[model samples]
Target: MIKRLSLISASVALGCIVTVAPVLTSIYIADEDAERREQEDLQQFAAKAVMRTELVTYQAFAAISDMEAPPGGLCSATQIAQFARVVFNYRYVRDAGAYGGGQYLCSPLSGDVRAQHLTMPPPDWRSKDGYLLWYRQKNPLSNERQDIQIGRNGNYVSIDPQSYVDLIDPARRPIAAINVETNTILALSPGADADDMLNAWKLAGQVNNEQWHYAVARSASRPLGVVVKSPRSSLVGHWPGLLVMWLSIGVVVGGVLGWIAFRRISRQLSFPATLEWAIARKKLDVVFQPIVRLTSGECVGVEALVRWNLNGRNISPEIFVAVAEQNGLIQQLTDLVLDKTLDELSKLLRSRPSFYVSINVSSEDLRTRRFLDVITARLQGTGIRPAQVRIEATERSFMDADATRQTIAAFRNAGHPVYIDDFGTGYSSLSYLQTFTIDVLKIDKSFIDTIAQDAASSVVAPHIIEMAHELGVEIVAEGVERDVQVEYLVQRDVQYGQGWLFAKPMGVNELVVWLSESSSTLQPIHQ
Candidate 1:
């Protein structure tokens, strides 16, 4: 009896560890990821901050370059006008002029009438170009905040110190730019103090999470540094809840069984690597969302949307597609989506000749002719027309305009209607639009949501519609959920629409049922 009790006790303890351990370990890894992401964000901010500061310095140098003492001298109307123009041209500079007798002889700030006396401190350092830099001194023209003054020959420019890190959002995170040599901060956003800045610099490239998480990133171009700090993320709140649930499961199961469950859970948590494996195994899910013709109130086509369900966690196409692209499995994933769409919808598409299924392709697909060739080959064996299997690409896919244009031309020549999805959301101009000949432009859902709102962006939808009309491309408004939007689009002669208002995305069986429900539209072509 004593031996059995001891064995039972050991088994229970071991079971608790085998199951709960994976959950705890995953949470720990997630916490570490949060900190690492924050550090990366800080690094990006530091680099951009340094670049902005460099831009400010270069602009000042350009404005004051080739500046020599004219016969009219420092206070001449021409010289004053030149300095005034410098102030006007350089967005970061507040004061610009030639220095003489230890005072700004004339500046745009002081007017052309009199010299501005600036009781500035001695220079912190002199550059190789004989330029003296005052790191920080009281702003003589503006508020009490300090300003950085750069002087060369008889010319000088006063720069607003905040311009170095003006792009930093104080509400999001506190960041500071410091002179690496002097360890003096040129400027700091709200929520950070001198102590925080100095301490972060001391622990540069190291992480600390006792009171606050902080990172210090240095500039490669100059002797400057940036510091950013964030509190523990809100994900911390989820730990306790998850711990309780996993612990209960662990205690109920034996050690070996618990470990088996743990292995599966870990695999799900390891989404990126599993995604690669899933693609090879052909475990991806593809659903269809119909695109409806507005005038007839009938479903004319469907957009093939890729989806993934791993242990009840449905991975969106946006994520899995990006994973595939990053891992060089994009063409494979595209093939999978294309083949699956054809496999499921070919019979239906053949029976209804005019109905189309739009297949999405990544920017990577446009880099080569592989995608077009693959689709053309697939359509040859099947009785389906290339026109019935349309091709849809986002604006980014057209980044390599010439290469993508040729691929698009190939697709068009093969009878596939090419569509530019998410228009007006990416880099836009008449150049890219006219450069590529497309059959349709799908205005992004974000613009459609603003159709009747009182916001300034409400006007963007109309402008996009007008632009598409001017370019002679047919318009298809996406995410049309309201009757008001439908009426608005129809009034402008926008031909087609896609979203939940007509029909939500459905499975292959569900879509077949949907088509049967619309009996008039589902009549067999040959019949």
Candidate 2:
């Protein structure tokens, strides 16, 4: 009993150590949560500030646009100049000017000063002593002609004004001008501090570094972004408390359980689980899912998903793949999956030359020269065109954005299509969509699950479809279950659909029959 207790203690300690590494790596020393919360609060504040300021600026510009030439109403050149000056002098406004009939109607109000127009009186003002000379000279060396030099025949260029106004009919009213300025409406928003808000904006902007900022830029009217300027030290400041909480939990429950587990397992029992041993032991298997075309009922592809047979039980790929990855056996495991998947695919390949098979490519495969040569050889041996073979990748593989880009280019150069699996769920989703020459974006099942229920997803589903359409990237919705989900995706014009809605993953013969039946129902009628 005493020996068992000691063994238990050691096993618990080992478990604690193993679990702590990943969890602690996830943890930070400072109060990032608090800082993030603070940042979010500041962003809200900033957004509110922007909206308030923007509305005020918009109103100001609209009012200025409403003003006509002054006799009975707010028209005189002096009045226009003063109004421009006053609007420009407003806290957010940077500069203001007015133009009429190809001449400066009034001096510009830039900074704190206002300069009157040299030719507001027109013909009389144009012919005066310095005026005639001003008209005669190629370019006058005076402040009065600065406007004349810069202004086109009948256009006004207002600098850094509060808001923008453009006259609808410039041909009819030569004096009419359009006013546009930075507006800086977002600066007035309320919420988190500017730094935190900015950080959140930056994080959100970094959405896989795919250049999704253009979306925000296109939707610039929504001031939901922030530029975090806080120091890294500030970000980590609040993490200590959470770390302590976690560590305390670790020391008590985690440590005790780990020590027990380590003690129970004997060294003699921990032999290498060889591939041959696994296969002989019935520890290898494959799950096949059908990929169909969006517009028709054509079964264009089948993705071979590999699963590990563990001690007579089917273990999830998630568990063993991680184990293989952690133990430096990922390459070996990947080879096993690929070989098994391709061998299985070969049975279906002959009848389905048009049928494509997609296998996942790991970072390990991309990094190794041998892996690339092997994949190439396999493709040639199978008589599969480079385009027929698709290599699926996760965001992390692509997050080493530079390497991923080069790898993708190489794959494309070889004629195979590369797809981002679980797309739109990664850090650089937008960036990858924009930067990498990806052929297909397999939308994550998470988004699909919510599509039928979430309003946000309803808008987002169509938006993603439209954006992908713009980029010429095909959108494939995965993990679809219901008829509603399929119908929704079809309506949104998703390019491909895969999930239980069609059929669950099956074996070779079963899949062949399922494919034949599915084809009958989903066949395309070509004209």
Candidate 3:
């Protein structure tokens, strides 16, 4: 038992692991894919931003390139101031002037700023014909510390850093344009510091530190490109909720699997157990096959067939019923069938009081008094009369002749007609007919199949018909599929028939509709 319990527990745990492993794996793959997509999107966004900024930078360059040099290879203060004003008039250009001898010659916002101090560019800035320089200083006009860009010589242009900074949306991660030559950030978005932003970019480049993702797009038309840095957390925010949900599902699946494993390993799992559960849950279904009078072609009765639907799969009655009999669960199964059939046929019985319903019975079902009690109790308050319900027993059911005879006598005393089912196929006892007071003998399909085929083969049904008549028992020809078979049964004066030619077995709801639609067409032979 301990070993069995351990196996059950292991099975449950295995089930959970199998179920959750894939979910976690898929989530991880989804995270990686999302990160990849985010990286691509950032790179694309930076590329587009660089393209737009390049347009404005080129416009600035054009403005400066068009300017003419002053006479004497130098610009006077007035010429410098006028040029500054004109350059500032262009969009994105903050201020412009010529610089020589360690001082600005003129400025539009600050006039004659000869004594003023200015930051020097790096030595590498001298080699480039055009250079972009970044420095922080108090603006002469606003008297506030400002991040500034200086476009030196006619080959370069100076513009407001905010123009490029504003291009980075506030909702997105910080972005900046860096000049690789000078190792300077020319412009940065709000909430970003040059030192911290540079460190982030460097850390992102290290394969060991992957917490941050950096997408860099270099400008083919300019010295600088945009770099976008985003934290990894932002890319996969919903993972926490997803992880919790799948883990919970895994636990649930594990519990269910463990229970199933326990049942199986303990030798307690069986179809009869399943059948009992079905009966308790009211899962048994009933279908009716029409039993028609061959001469009149009118449906006089229906056979109640029990069907089991377990977890969306149909369990054949042959398999489950045999299992039930072996396990001594047939009594419970029969009771469920009777209750379900009575409940379903309640309406039809009310409309057609004369309509009889035949129900199959096992020898085990008749060996006890409880079976008779169940039948009596089920019929007590319903509109069904005991006469309207027929009990069908196969010849195999009569193996214990005394018990079978006693059960048949009890049913007859209770006013329920008893019929021998699958007549030609079973024991074929002439003694059962003489010994038991039987009302009907249903000719099995095998014998009916031989009818009208070969005269010698067809001889059995006629003899059975003649014998049934002699015994004053009505005959039901089962499996009468063709018109010729119907004519043969009618000619032989077989009273009732059931087969696909009339109607296939249908559910209770379908039987109601079938009866309604076929009622007018089914007429007596004399009519």
Candidate 4:
């Protein structure tokens, strides 16, 4: 009994360790990720602020550049005042004037201050040629400190620092702008302080501070730099909630491990179980590939393809569909594909009554009544005619020959067309054409792809088309991506074609735009 008690204690301890280690590790990683994202966001914000400031500065400079210098080499009082008024109309320009001969010549606010012998202060920030300068000085009218810029030809434009500062989003974080040459604070948001602002400037491009994080980006067009600062707490505001979730997960995992130590339980679940979860959450989506008429190059129909977005990754349809079919989940997947296709294409179908959308179905889907019921229910009041919906099944999907034939006949009786998809790649049995009521034969991409490579080896596609034509079935050549391929299909009298050359698979909104843009040039198939 003592030995058994010791073993139980050891197992419980090991389980707790196993459970706690990962939760703690995940929390640490989460904190690090949050910090990294915060730094990146701050850098982006600073870059944008600097860019906006530079644009305003450049606009003012451009306006000044357009003004011709007075003929007498000194701007008259009237001309200076008028130029200043034009500059002041811009949002960022606070005042404007002309300065020459170490004297203030004229200004819109204080015209002709020539007697003052005004001295132009050495610029806190200046261009290489001393053409553009930004400095701080007292406003002659308001008698308050102001930031100003001087152009090359004695034209001066004062800047409203408040306008530049207000461009930074105050609700995001504490931000400030400073001159790189003079180390002067050009502007600062309400919550920011001089001490923190200076610290942030020093800590630019670094995130090692324990109390505060800093990001800075200098404008390429000017000498100004923008700094974004945030307290460590704000950077990791979600840490507490993450900690609670991790703790709860740890408790549950530890209990499960401990239970497994005593009771032998199978931990492996089937693929269908996971797939069922995905289906329940509606993680399926549909994309449409246009089918064009070769002669007129007009889109006549679209093929609906289902996509699986699982865990932020896209899983290929071939792998998932095969697994689903083996595990008896194909019916559910097919039903979902049908519902999503009809719902998405309903608008296009209603607007263009002649347009058709094809949906792929598996052998299992054809064998069951549930598939037909799903299609019927989804199209009841959706403004989609029964004929507008086409069913496409592969040659192998006809393995249950009787059931597939019955389904196809029933579908045809209800005004829906059934097409044989991926022909010449699958079962490729001639009996499929003779036995089932196939309306369209879509030659697989494998055959169409070989048409350009080996003329002799690619003879199968033409023969297939001839045979399909003899049986009164329309031909659709898939993967027609080249001009040569289009010419070949049109020459062979192929009715419908689809490939990336025309358009790749697109979402509903993109299809609507494409249709609107191409409608004028598109013509219906001859027959």
Best by lDDT: 1
Which residue pairs in model 4 clash with each other? Answer: none
lDDT for each residue of candidate 2 in 8-122, tens digit (9 for 90 to 100): 9887667666866545443442345555554443333232222232333333343344333333322345555655655455433332344555345443443212243344333
Ranking by lDDT: 1, 4, 3, 2
Kindly list the per-residue Cα lDDT of model 4 for residues 178-286, writing each as its tens digit: 7776666777777778676766676664646687778777764467777777766442456667555545565456667546643532322445677777876778788
Residue 39 of model 2 has an lDDT of 44
Model-by-model lDDT, in order?
0.75, 0.53, 0.70, 0.72
Question: What's the TM-score of every candidate structure?
Answer: 0.51, 0.55, 0.49, 0.49
Clashes of 1: 0
> Higher TM-score: candidate 2 or 3?
2
Clashes (N, CA, C under 3 Å) per candidate: 0, 63, 0, 0
Worst 10 residues of 3 by lDDT: 118-127
Clashes in predicted model 3: 0
Against the true structure, candidate 2 reaches a TM-score of 0.55
Look at candidate 3 and give me any clashing residue pairs.
Answer: none
